[model samples]
Target chain A: MTTITKLPDPVAGGSKHPQRGKTPRPGRGRRLGDLRIALLFILPAMVGFVAFFLIPTIRGIYLSFTEYSVLGDPTWIGTKNYTAIFADELFWNAMAVTLQYVGLNIGFQTVIALGLALLMHRVAKSTLIRGALLLPFLVANVIVALLWFWMLDYQIGIVNEIINWFGLPRIAFFGSEQWAIPTIAGVNVWRHMGYTALLIFAGLQSIPSHVYEVASLDGASQTRTFWSITMPLLRPVLVLVLVVTVIGSFQVFDTVAVTTGGGPINASRVIQMYIYQKAFGESDFGYASALSVILFVILALVAFIQMKFLKGNESDLD
Target chain B: MKKTLGAVAAAAAIALSLSACGGSAPASSEAKGEINYWLWDANQLPAYQQCADDFTKANPDIKVKITQRGWDDYWTTLTNGFVAGTAPDVFTNHLSKYPEYAAKKQLLSLDDAVAKDGIKLDSYTKGLPELWVGQDGKRYGLPKDWDTVGLFYNKAMTDSAGLTAGQMANLDWNPKDGGSYELAIAHLTVDKNGKRGDEAGFDKNNVAVYGLGLAGGGSGQGQTEWSFLTATTGWTATDKNPWGTKFNYDDPRFQESIAWWAGLIDKGYMPKLETTVGASLADNFGAGKAAINTTGDWLIGQYQSYKGVETAFAPTPKGPEGKRASMFNGLADSIWAGTKNPAASVKWVEYLGSTACQDVVASKAVVFPAITTSADKAAEAFKAKGTDVSAFTTHVKDSTTFLFPIADKAAKVDGIMKPAMDAVLAGKKPASSLTEANSQVNALFK
Candidate 1:
């Protein structure tokens, strides 16, 4: 039988594996054939990292400090772009809208997703329902956004027709400044609902149903049983879904663009849209990169706090 | 079951791909390496294709490969190509965007090309060559076409309001007391309660239609719309104003113009601000939703689909300055400085400037020739479609116009202008507060 030999990366630090094979001394040539084979396996990935990811990433960070127009040589005006970005009211406004969007949809996507997941677990015996429920999630997000745009058009939209049928005033889903962000959030929720539900459904299925039956036998009601049994068990999956959804919400762009064009005045403008505008519409890449760096820091910080507060480790699963 | 689900997910991911990539089916094996040409107007490409065919007949070695995209996408792709180093050999240029590209040194200077081709400056409109000149006084493009802001009013709407075409044709604005055009606009304005704006004691809140439509807020900066307000109010966009970097949109006259524009929205004479930011003011007019749309002469054929709609052209309403003032704007054929063959590129530009090509381009549609002589063909093209474009020539003498500035800092100004106008349109900021935008833009320019 063949065994794989691998060395821990210096960046990753100390290996956890039981050392049956002798480790090579630092900077010394490899003595073992397995070590050479391991290197051969890892070489492609390391080359790819250097060629594609690391080089461009470093360059992008360097470019962030300059006011580049993409067409010409980027002139370094160190921190000027960053200073301008902070002073920009639209940048702040876009950040606020993005926060609102993330805050609004984070709870919504999770709640709706978990609710559907619970419902799916209850009805797990039905094959057709399980398959059909996920169609919206299966559909492409860009297509979903486009479909919703047409469905929400002012003059001839289906959403209006449906509301009119109910004797309620037709809502201007995409156009109105007040409703634009909410509309985008709602569509985002609708698009992701099925996939998130599927994730929680898998998580739910992993939990033995005997515990639920035990609770029922102990005279536990559905609500009481869910809070006591399901809530504790789904913590790990919930944390994962929440983290991903929050990140996704912060980066939201295409839908807002397809529907509103940041219109009725910057009401639906988001950070990514601002980045896109500066980078393309105005050809101000340096400022856009500054925005990007800000966004990256926000995402990283948020993710860190989420990891700390939510306790995503295995010990918290109990 | 999990394995099957994984397969389905994988299939879905595969389906998620399929970006509309790949060039057209490879052309017939020909000697002249295919030159990539980007264009926006799908309606106008057949003539380009015809021109390409004619050009190919003369130079069999050159195959003009054309890629048509929307204006928004065209700019997006061209800008992306600048970074990727895969930009097309040739593409259309606009006054608003040329400065940035030229400043970046992305555009090739046509100075040598123009001289070599013996292309005389006298053939173009006075000061027209300045449109393609970068901030450093480098000429990067040759003038392609000229367009001046004017008014396109629905004759049917005016006739129904009991106004004659002759009166509307010469309609001018005096921004001082809301000129004669505003008076007529008031007369034509209709409310939800069917009250006319000109009627004594007419209600403004329940307005069903606005008589005059000048694109406002973010879109007011649109060439025709903003030019109408600024030129009439005596704000100079060119010649005297070297600070293309900062707009005086915050000045008293400009603010008053903005207030007047916003008043149309506030009074319910026009659509709500949210309703028309990036939305088509053109489509609004064509649907009989609005009566008077302030657009350029080029929009003459754009509204032809509106059945039986008799549209007439008029100069912008005169402002406090009087004299029905306006600004002239135009487009140019720019060469990218980073191009592999600057010589080959100018030959292409010179060909575009040639009367034969301009005639071909003009004969096809309502596009006015940048060349003075071939403009009649464009006018004739419009006349064939049963619309006279003679009004375009008449206003050139009186209008104080310039192309949209291409200051190296154009991107910075736009960044400031978009949000500032957004604030004004949303009513969060006063129109006069645009001085903040002006200062921010000025900072970038310096």
Candidate 2:
């Protein structure tokens, strides 16, 4: 297609403007043609974005200020739904749970992923081990949750069996209030660590081998070389992983829904589950939308703060 | 790149337009009447398909297409369908959701259709016909089948414990003392060292098998969990039957019953809440890991199919009210208000609720039919299959039964109660948690 457009220009230059020995302005038709071609290139994406994302988001914001149950016509209720959510104790409780879940998930996933990446990078010969480690990441969230639900069962689970073998009492992983949230975070980390580790591994590989060679020449210890070279170079990828993970942890629903249904006393009922209950479970779409907007603001604020913090102070690498 | 983009865009536009126009409209005879019917239960699919075949044979012009979804997805998708204007011409409805749908005018009122078709509503079980009536006194659906909770015990285990049928059948219960039913559960619960739960030296932590299946921590309905016992204690879900605005979760009797139900965990007679998380109580019972299961009668066929398991059914134990009570709930076939073929759809619903079709369902014995005669036939068919379904039939015929709770904000009630109930069942708190939960439930109405 670019070839066709170029052909027209060459033809115009040779046949019509050759003797003038001057660079010609593109014809109005040719300029319009370029515009059409650009539009053609972008139209499909634009249509999808408008249809699925833009329209729904605008409508959701509109709904947050109105009273609607999906089945009936929405009534203009002003800011009533938003005010109600602010006053609702359950909403705040869900927010607190969601924050704790995000903290635990991000903290565990980052440490596990970076540690695994370091270990796997050292054993570079074992591609099969890397693939095997990634098997959990490939499994669907629901399947992972269901598998863990059984594995963590207090009586019949293999986990409890192993615990009993060591002359220790079995832990009620999902049933106990203190254990439920942390156990869920552990499961999320278990399922996601492989993917995050692989990302870090890619970043590690991108740090030129000569940099490590130079560090070895300097007689820097392994830990010292890592701190001076690898860590600084891995900053951007780390930020990317951290942001993606924080966003995802806030939206955790499938694992919680399947494993606990946010139970043993709402210990695992994160914000997404609460919003889901309000929207689909109770048919309170307006209130749900209000809660959703609040979540959106929270996530945006968190992401901004993270980006600011990550970019600030010109760390030794910068 | 430009031409490729144009081609891709054109294809996407075509696809979008095609999807916008997709999905066949509701069946009308003029456009080849092929009505879609939806239901949730996979076990009932074969029986319903057989009925659809029979309906098609009788009415050659209309074709019935049946689709099955799981229980949770069925309601979610159906509600979404109602919003999308793509709901099936006819679909199965539940008592819990029908009222809300009817209130929203999503269901086609079948009152005039029933009168015009001369359908006898009396043919269904006694309370079922009235159950389909909405708050406005309009009939929104036709009764299809009913179910009740019962005590399912492993016959071999009960017999080995020297528990006779008479003792099991005559057991009565109270909140203070657990009656003979508790004793039976204790006797059946054996530790890894061959001591019963009732024995002094029994190791509660090392019990090999629970005497009762408490799989899946707790249910909001209390259907199989504690509803039977609680109902027998004269506890009702709401102030009224069909559309009660107030719930009674904070009632003293109800709280006591839940406390006792949760106490079984301490006694080592029931599975811990954590152990129940992803386990199916029915599967546990079928595998002989649970000595008894208090659940709905719909699982009878599933248990009967287990090779080495010998199952027996008994009524829920009588309570302080001097009567055994169970939640009597039923399914109905409703017409979508958006349906184009109301006449044909009504015809299909009437047939589904008729004896001819119900008899097919009864013969399958997967579920008890709504029609009293069909229910009796189902019992005889089960007897022929070497299983008795009278445990459920008796609830309909003789036992004192309460209607399943229905309310405007039923889902809100659940959102409030389920976690609170889970707390009690998990032993984190007593049933007193319902005090705050009840306030939340009532707040929804306000």
Candidate 3:
């Protein structure tokens, strides 16, 4: 446990001074040296965080209450943008569509990733296999969307060609309102599932092998061992994965933008696409900022709930 | 902690100052300096490069740097540039966007310069120069080129369908019965069972070749899709164009025309709206999956470029007005208000709008220059390439062309109309649904 706590602190090793008295409080000189070095090391990252993340987040929040058209100075509009968004049918439709996509993407991704991770843990632990599984995640989102777009085309795409060969009607994967969201979700799942599986695989590796061996010795069936021991031990990792993936799925944009452009008639207009259309397409940056602020609040609340309800910080092994 | 705070503050100060320096405007306006120019069309880049070279030769003090980006990225980057004050000295402007930019004072008014230089606005094609004049009576840009829509058909498919060149050229349309245009489309469309759309036992469900390729939902403007049809029915998009405060999308004549256009999908004369997404209509026509495509003259080169497919152009069919109609859209060059080399920028724009540059552009046969003589030269160039572009030019000759609708909140208008139009095209809702969308668009103006 001590080693585990110290594992992430590489600076701790160099900070140890035999000349200093063995006390909880280090000598002033040594402390100063450590502080300076630590400050120097983290300064670049701190500057980036402040400049890109913190400042923009604050500015975005401020701009949400204004009417900025990206051409002229932003004007104070108070909560008008928010009020309009609340009453906007398109905004509600976008939210519903985004939720549907998130549900489909995360649900399939989590189950498939968990299955792949288990298969890797029990059967094929080769680095080659892991790398092969992760290839799709390495490709750009736009490229993946375009590739699948052609492959799933209604008339001449290879997938539809196969469907035709099988004497089934070709599916309008990206074109139909009913299939657009599911198709986008499916494409993203294919791209992300491999990376997700590897994350779960890492969590699996961290589980002490002795626990599994002891369960076996107790004459525990594989199913019972998985349900009682493995499941609980994997809960924290699963929670983290869910929080990350759910947040990611909510912001689904590139695939839909490249493929559907929020069509077959608002059938696949996710929140991000709607925000993008407002900001860039309509030059309504204030409305777009407000939309993003809401998204941020929702994500924050979701993460907090996930951490609290799932007890994601606590581990069964601990 | 104090030392750390001081160091962090210093670092942040350095970063902020660096960014400030990066955003600083160039030295004061000069008639002789390097001027950055930007345009969206890659095809016109080389032609413009030649123009730039010639301009540099004539005025060695002024060097031009040209950049080109695809359509979507061009507008996005230009908008960001406007905010950052790093926009090019000159850029290609569209009618839909310039109105907004002019309203916001992002565009430099070219009226004084035009008057000072004695540049004749009458040299440009009729209605071309007036498009650049803002609501405030300021000329924001100088017209460069113009485009109009026509029917591009697969010649082999049309010939096999027993359609003659004369028959294809003289086709007429009406919203009530769909006229000879619909008949041509039906005769050309073939099913998997090798039956024409007009033939008995024709399978609309399994169309092997759509008679008319669906370009898109045509959001608001319907420029190439149904604008010609709607115009022929005397159904305008707005109460007045340019700065029109009201939209007329709910007009029964317009709705009926759109309904007739959408009905083609059900009849298998056109592909489903869903099928057109992410698929190029020109490619569909080239692949023999579509027999005919109604598109702008700008795509003439692209449609002609498909190897092994013999393509030909025909004038848009005559409508109820007893004349064919097309949306006459033109592109122009405008100077950015934030430019440091405003004089040089205006000079470059003037040269671009002049016959000197336009002739070079026309010689390439890529597009029709705004100048009447330059446009004629372009037609000859097309003839030299063995492609007759009279189908597109005829609308201009017959004065049946309508101005491309220009208005404020154009993007918002498109946003409201795209889905509404898409729903109608997808057969999920009737054309009457547009009446609801029309009110929402009108509300934006209010």
lDDT of 1 by residue, A45-147 (tens): 9987766666655666777898766544568999998898889888999999999999788889889889889888885658788777788888888899999
Model 2: how far is A149 from its true place, Å?
3.4
The parts of candidate 1 lying over 4 Å away from their true place are A1-35, A73-84, A161-171, A315-318, B1-32, B200-206, B214-220, B237-246, B397-403
Q: How well is each residue in B1-446 modelled by candidate 3, as lDDT tens digits?
A: 12223333443443344344332223244689899999998888999999999999999999999999999899988877776556898999999899988887778788778877889899999999999999988899899999999999999998998899999999999999899999999999999999999999999998999899998889999999999999999989989977898999899999999999999998888988888877888888888889899999989999989998999999999998798999999999998776767778888999999999999999999999999999999999999999999999999999999999989889899999999999999999999999999999999987
Each candidate's interface RMSD (Å, one decimal) is: 10.9, 9.0, 8.3
Better model by TM-score, 1 or 3?
3
Give per-residue lDDT, candidate 2, residue A249. Answer: 92
Best-to-worst order by TM-score is 3, 2, 1
Cα lDDT of all candidates, in order?
Answer: 0.70, 0.82, 0.89
- After superposing candidate 2, which stretches have Cα over 4 Å from the reference? A1-45, A120-122, A125-133, A154-156, A164-167, A208-218, A312-318, B1-32, B216-220
Q: What's the DockQ of model 1? A: 0.22
Of candidate 2 chain B, the 10-residue stretch with the lowest lDDT total is B1-10
lDDT of 1 by residue, B249-323 (tens): 557777776767666666556666655533477777877667887777656667666776767876665555545
Candidate number that wins on DockQ, 1 or 2: 2
> Between prediction 1 and prediction 2, which has the larger TM-score?
2
RMSD to native, candidate 3: 5.8
